[model samples]
Target chain A: MSAKEYRFRLFVAGNEPNSRLAEQNLRALCQEYLPDRYDIEVVDVLTDFEAALDSNVMIAPTVVMEAPRSVTLFGTLANKAAVISALAL
Target chain B: MVENQLPNIRKCHTRIEGLDQILQGGLPTGRTTLMIGGPGSGKSLFGLEFLYRSALAGEPGIFISFEERADSLKNNAATLGWQLAPMEQAGKLFLLEGRIDPRAVITGDFGIQSFFAILDHKLKAMGAKRVVIDALDVLMRLINDSRREQDELVALHQWLAERDVTALLTVKAPREGQLERNYDFLDYLADCVIQLDNRMLGQLSTRRLRVVKYRGSGFGSNEYPFVIGSPGITLLPISEVGLSHQALGDRVSTGLTALDDLIGGGFRRASSVLITGGTGTGKTTLCSVMAQMACARNEKVLYISFEESEAALVSAMRSSGTDLSSTLALGQLRLLSAMPEAMGAEQHLVRTLVLIKQMQPSFVIIESASACKRMGTEQAAFEYLMRLINTCKEMGITVVTTNQTAGLHNLDEISGIGISSLIDTVIQLRLLEENAFLRRKLLVMKSRGSSHSHSVHDFAITDQGVVILQKAD
Candidate 1:
C-alpha cells in the first residue's frame, strides 16, 4: 500500500532453533515476495538486549514491520500465509 | 512452636509483619518460592510486599507481571502508601509488564530465551537480588503445550539457581475445570512453596496462609490467619505474645473498699478479671468505676465500650457523680466506643490490637462481652477475648471484662464466651427480692491464689456511686 520500501526488524536470542529458522525463512520469504523493495535488520538479543527491551520484544523471533502500517509479530514464521497477511506482504 | 533453622540455608527476611516468624527467618536466599492460590487470594499483594520491603531493606528487586500491568501493580502498592516510582527512580527496583499481546500470530515455536535475555539485562542494570514473576501460569498458558511449559519451568528454575537473585513465582491453582495438567513439578523445582487461602466462615471473611514445603529449612506449616490491613498483610499467628506470660504482679484496688476487702487485698496487677451479671445488674457501672479508679492511681487506662457510645459512657459516668474530665485531660484514660456491629470481627480484633500497641495502657476495660458477640459468632468472640486477655497478660496489663447474662438464675454459667479458666478473678452480681422491693447483691465468686468472702453482700446504686453495705439490713 505504501510507495516507500518495507522496513522489517526481527528480534532474536542468538542461534536458537526457532530464531535461526525464522531468520532463514524471513529472508527467503522476502526474496520470493518483494525482491528489492524491503529492508531487513536482525537483532540478536544475546548481544543487543537493550534494543529488544526498548522495542518491547517479549520472545525470540519477534518481527516488527514498518511498512504499509506498523505492526509486530512473533514466532518461527514457518506459517508463511499468516506472516504474509500479518505483514501485509 | 518455633523451629531452629539449619545453617546451610540463608534467609532473606520478607519484613512482612509476623510473617518472618512463620518462615523461621524468611524464604531461602537465592531459591525459588512458588505461591499457589485462587483468584483474590492475595498472591500478587504478597509478592508486591516482598519486593517493596526488599527495596526498603537496601536489597534491589525486580517484578515481572505477566497477568497485570505494571501500572496496576504500582496502583495497588500505592494503596498501601508504598511509592514504587521513587524506588524505580533510584534504580533499586524494576517493574516489567510482560503480558503478551493477545493478537500476536504464532507460526512455529517460542520459548523463554528472549524473556530471560531481557530479564537478565534488566536485573544486571538494576542489580536486583530479588525477583517476582507474578502469574507465571499466564505465560505458561500462552506457550499452551504442556511439554514446553515443563521445559520452560525447569529452564526458569535453573536460571534462578545459577544467578544470585532469589525469585517468587505466583501461580493460579487450577480449579475444577481442569481435568489434567496439575503443576506437581513446581514442588519438585521450587525450594519453597507457600499456599494462600481465602475462605468465608459463614458471614465472616477470613484469609489464611500456610507453608506447604520448605526444603532444607525450618518452617511453620500450620495455617496462620492473616488480615490485609493498612500495612498490606499482617499474619496473626495468635501466638508469640501468648507464649511469654509472667506471674501476676502486685495488688491493685477495685475502687470500692468493700469490694477490695472481699477479694483479699484487691485484684492483682496484670490479672484478668471477669464480671458476669444480668441486664440491670450494673456490669457497665462496675467497669466505669474500675476504669476511673485505675486512672485515679495515675495509671493509663483503655476503656473499650462495645455496648455504649463514648458520649453515652461519659454521660453515664457524669450521672453517676464520678467525673472523668481530669483523667481524660491528663491523658491517663482513653475511652474508645464502637458499635458491636460497626466492623467485622477480624477488623475489630486488629483495631483493638493496634490500640493496645499504641496506648500501651496499664489497664484495659472491655465494657461487655455479650455485645462483642454481635461482631461475629460466639466462637469469634471467644477468640477475640482469648487473644485480648492473653496479650494483656503477656504485657502485664490488667484487663477487666464484663459479660451480660440472660437473668439472675444463670450465675454459674459465666455468660456465653466460656473463657472462665483464663480469668484470674470472677465477680458475680445478682438481683434479689426482699421486703417486696428489688435488691442488688455482689459476691466475689472466685479469686485465684487469694482468700475471698463467700457471703453475698447487699449493694445499693447510690447517687454518689455503688456502695456495698457491709453491715446494713
Candidate 2:
C-alpha cells in the first residue's frame, strides 16, 4: 500500500512567542512521525492580511488541515493532543 | 429650478403607528442612534429593522456585522419573515462581515483606521442612509486600552456625523453595571439613546425598551414592552383609562349556555377575566369555549397558550364540542404556544403584541399564565401581565387568561393572582367534593364592565365539550 500524504497550513499573524511555540511543537512531531510525506504551509497575516481575513481566522496560532473533502480549523495549535488527534498522524 | 430645491426634511418614520407618536414623528432623519442592551436583549434585530425600513423607504442601507457571519444574519432575518436576501440582491442593502484582531492593535499592525477605511468605502459605494454596526463590544477588544477605545468610538461617531448618515451602533451592557461604560461615549455622540432590557419575572422573561434620551424631541420615558416577530419589532402603548370608563354588557356565553345562564348571561366584552383553578379543573377548556364563542361572532381571537401545543389545543377544543378548526382555518382564531422555560414573560407580552398586530383579534386568551411564573421572578411576571392586560384593554380586546391554583383549599397560594385585581372580571373554577362526589364549580369573582351572576355554576368536560349545569339557586 502507498503512504498517505498530509497537507497542513499553520496560520500565524507574526513570529510571536505563541506562534513560535506552536511551530516548534508541530515540527518536532511531524519530523519524528511522518518525515517523508507531509507538506507544511506557514502563513503570516502581517504580509497576507487579506488571506487571513478571507479564511475567517478569528484566533491566532490556528492550524488548518485542508483535505479534499473538507477543511478543519483547530483554534489553538498549543494543544498537542488535539493537534495530533485532528491530523490523525 | 426654483421649485426643485430640497423640501424640508422630516423625521425618519419608524413605521410603527404608536411609536411615531411617542417619538413625535419618529427618529431624526440622517442621524445616528445608539442602542445598548445586555446580551440577548435583541439589539441586533432592532438595528436590522431600522436598516430594513430604510430599504423599504427607497433608501439603501448597510449592515456591518462584527459578531455574526453573513449567512447567519440572513437566516435570522428570514425567521422574522423579513426577506433580506432580495434587498441585498437589489443593491438596496449591503452586509459586510468584519473581523479585527484584539491582539493586532497591541502589536501595531492594524488599528481603527482599517475599520474606518472599510466603512467609508461601503457607505460611499452603497450611498447608504442607514448603517448598523452590530454590537461594538467585539470591536472594543481591538483596542487594548479602554481610553483609546473610547476615543475611537467618539471619532467614529463624528465621522459618521460628518457624512450625514444615520447609524445605529449597538453595544452589550457590562455584566455588573446596568449600562456599559462605552455607552457613555456613544450616548454623548448619538442623537438618541435607546436601552433594551430583559428581566426575569417569576418564571417569565420580560423584555422592555425605553428611550433613555432623544435629543431635541419629546419622547415617552416609560419602558414599553416590545415584541419581535414577522412584522418585526412593535411597541405596545398602554392607555390609562379611568375607572368610570368601565361599561356593562350582557354575559356572553362561555360557549356553555347553561354556564352563561349561571353567570346571568356570559363573560362581558372588553373585560379582564381570570380563570383560576387547581390543575385539571378544566380552566383551559373554559378558555377555549370563550375564544370559540368570540370567533363565532366574527370577532378576532388570540389564544396565547403557555401549556398545550396548537394541535393539542385544537383537539381539546374539538373534544369540548367547539368547532375551532373552522375559526383557525378562517384566521379568526390565532394560537400562540410558548414554552415557559424558553422565553421570559416580557417576551410573551411582546409576542402577544405581535399577534395582536397581525390578526387584530378582539378576544385574547393566555392559557395558564401561572406557568409563566416558573420562568422568572413573580413580581416581574405580574408587572408584565399587568402591562399586557392594560394594553389589551386600551385596544378594546376582551382578554381572558387561565392561572393554575396550587391547592383547592388554599386560595392564597394562587399563582399570578396579583393580576386578578387588575382584571375587569375574575372567574374562579374549583374542584369541589360534595355528597361524596368530585365536581367542578365556576364562580365569577368580579366583572368590571358588566353585571354578572353572583351564584356559582357547576360544569363538567366530556368528549362532547363543556356541559354547564344549573346554578345552585
Candidate 3:
C-alpha cells in the first residue's frame, strides 16, 4: 500500500528573514524525505491574521503536521533533526 | 432604523416576557453578556435561543460554536420548534463551527485572533446584530496560560463592542477548583453575568437562572426557576416587582345557594378559596358544582386535576348531578390532568403558569392539595402552591383549591401544610358518624375581609348537586 498522506501548515509573519528561511527549510525537508506524500500550505499571519488564528497560530515560522497525529514545532525549521522528529517524517 | 432610533438607554429585548420585565427591558445593547453554568445547565440552549429569537425579530445573528457541530445544533433547535435551517439558508443567521480537532492540530501556540477574523467576516456578511460564542471554555482551554485567557476575553469583548453587536458568551464551570476558574475574570469583562445552575433533590432535578450582575442597570438578582421544553426556555418569576393588581367587588355564585349564604354570598372575584376535607367528604363535588356555576355564567374554568384523569373526573361528576360534558364541549371548561411525580416542582409550576396564560380562565380549581406532595418536600410544595395562588390572584382570577385531611373528625388541622394561612377563605368539610349512619358536615372556617357563618350545617350530595340542609340564619 502507498504511504499515508501527510498534511502540513506552516505559519509565518510576512516575508521576514526567519520566515523565508523557515519556508526554504520546510520545502527542502519535504522534497527530500516525503516527496509525493506530503503537502505544505503557507499562511502569512501579517496578511491573513484571521487564518492564523483558525489553526491557533501564535508564534511565527511555526510548522504544523496534520497526519497520523498532530505535532507542533515553534521557530524556524532550520533544525532539521528536530523538525523530522516532531513531524514524524 | 428602529434599532438606531432606540432610546439612548439602549436595550436588547430577551423576548422572554417575565425575564425582560425582570431585566427592566432587556440586556444592555451591543455588549457582551457572560453566561456561566455547569454541565446540563442549558447554557448553550440559552445562548441559541437568544440568537434565534433575535433573528426572528429581524436582527440577524451568528452562533460561533467551539464545541458542538453546526448540524447537531440545528437538530437540537428543531426539536424546540425553531427551524434554524431556513434562517441559515435565507442568510438571516449564520453558524460558525470553530472546533479544531485536537488530533489534527499540530500547533500548540495559537490565539483567538483567527477565530475573531472569521467572526468579523461572518458578522459583516450576515449583518448580524447578535452573536453567541458557545462553550467559550473550550476556546479558553486552547491557551494554557490564565493571562492569555483573560486577554483573549478582553479582546473579544472589545471586538464585539466595536461592531455594535449584542453578544452572549457561554462557559462551563470547572468541576473542581471553581474559585480558581476564570469566571471572575469573565465576570469583570462582561456587561452582564448570568449563572445557570442545575441541581438535584433526591429524584427531582431543577434548573434555575440567576443574574449575577448587570452593569449600570437595576435587575432582579433572585434565582429564577426555568425549564427547557416544547416552546423553549421559560423562567418562572414567582412575584412581580409590586402588587397593584386591581380587585373587583363583584361576587360570583358557589352553585349552592345555602352554601353561598354560609360564606356570605359566594366568593369575591380574584379571591383564593380553599376547601379542606377528609376523604369522601365531597370536596371535589363542591369544586365541580362551583366550576359548573362559573361555566354557566359564560366564564371559563380551568380544572387542574392531579388525582384523577379527565374522563374519570367528568364521569364521576356526571354521576353526582353535574354535567361537565356540555361545558367541556363549549370550550368554557378545560381540564389538565398531570401526574405531578413525573416532573420537578418547577417544571410543573412553569407548565401550569403557561397553561393559565394561554387559557385565561376566570376560575382555576386545583382539585387536590395532595398533588403538591409530588414536589418532594412539604416546604417546596407549599412554596409552589403559594406562587400558583399569587399568580392567579394577580390576574384577577378566582382560585379554588382542595386539601384532603387525614381522619373523619380531625378538623383541627386544615391541610397540615401551613398553606391555609395564605388562603383567603377556608371551607371545612368533615364526615361525622351519627345515629349509626355517616353524615357530612360543612362549615366556613374562615373568610378574610368578610364575615362567615359560624354554625355547622348538614351537607349532602343529592340528585341536584351539593345542598346545605340548614337554612340561612
Say which prediction, candidate 2 or candidate 3, comes out ahead on lDDT. 3
Cα deviation of B254 in candidate 2 (Å)? Answer: 4.1
The runs of at least 3 residues in candidate 3 whose Cα sits more than 4 Å from the true structure, single-residue gaps closed, are: A1-32, A43-88, B1-9, B105-108, B178-181, B408-412, B471-473
Across B269-335, the per-residue lDDT of candidate 2 in tens digits comes to 6777777888888888888878877877788888888799999988877876776888888888888
DockQ of 1: 0.63
Query: Can you write out model 1's per-residue Cα lDDT over B1-473, one digit (the tens) per residue?
Result: 24454557778888988888888888889999999988989999999899888888788988888888888888888887888888888888888888877777777887677789889888888888799999999888878888888899988899998897789999998886774363788878999999998877547777889999999877776888787767678887676443676688999899998899999999999899999888888888888888899988888999998888777778777877677777888888888889877666666778888889989999999878888788767777777888888888889999999988877445346844777867888888888888999989887888988999988888988779989897334
Q: Candidate 1 falls in which docking quality class?
A: medium
Measured by lDDT, the strongest candidate is 1
Full candidate order by lDDT, most accurate first: 1, 3, 2
Interface RMSD of 2: 8.8
Q: Which digits, one per residue and each the tens of the lDDT, describe model 1 over residues A1-89?
A: 33548888888889888989998999999999989888888899888977877766778888878675787777889899989998877
TM-scores for the candidates: 0.91, 0.69, 0.88
Q: Give all candidates' CA lDDT scores.
A: 0.83, 0.71, 0.79
- Interface root mean square deviation of every model, in Å? 1.4, 8.8, 5.6
Q: Give one digit per residue, the lDDT tens place, for model 2 in A2-86.
A: 3347667776757666666666776777888779666678877555655555665544555565642234533335566655665
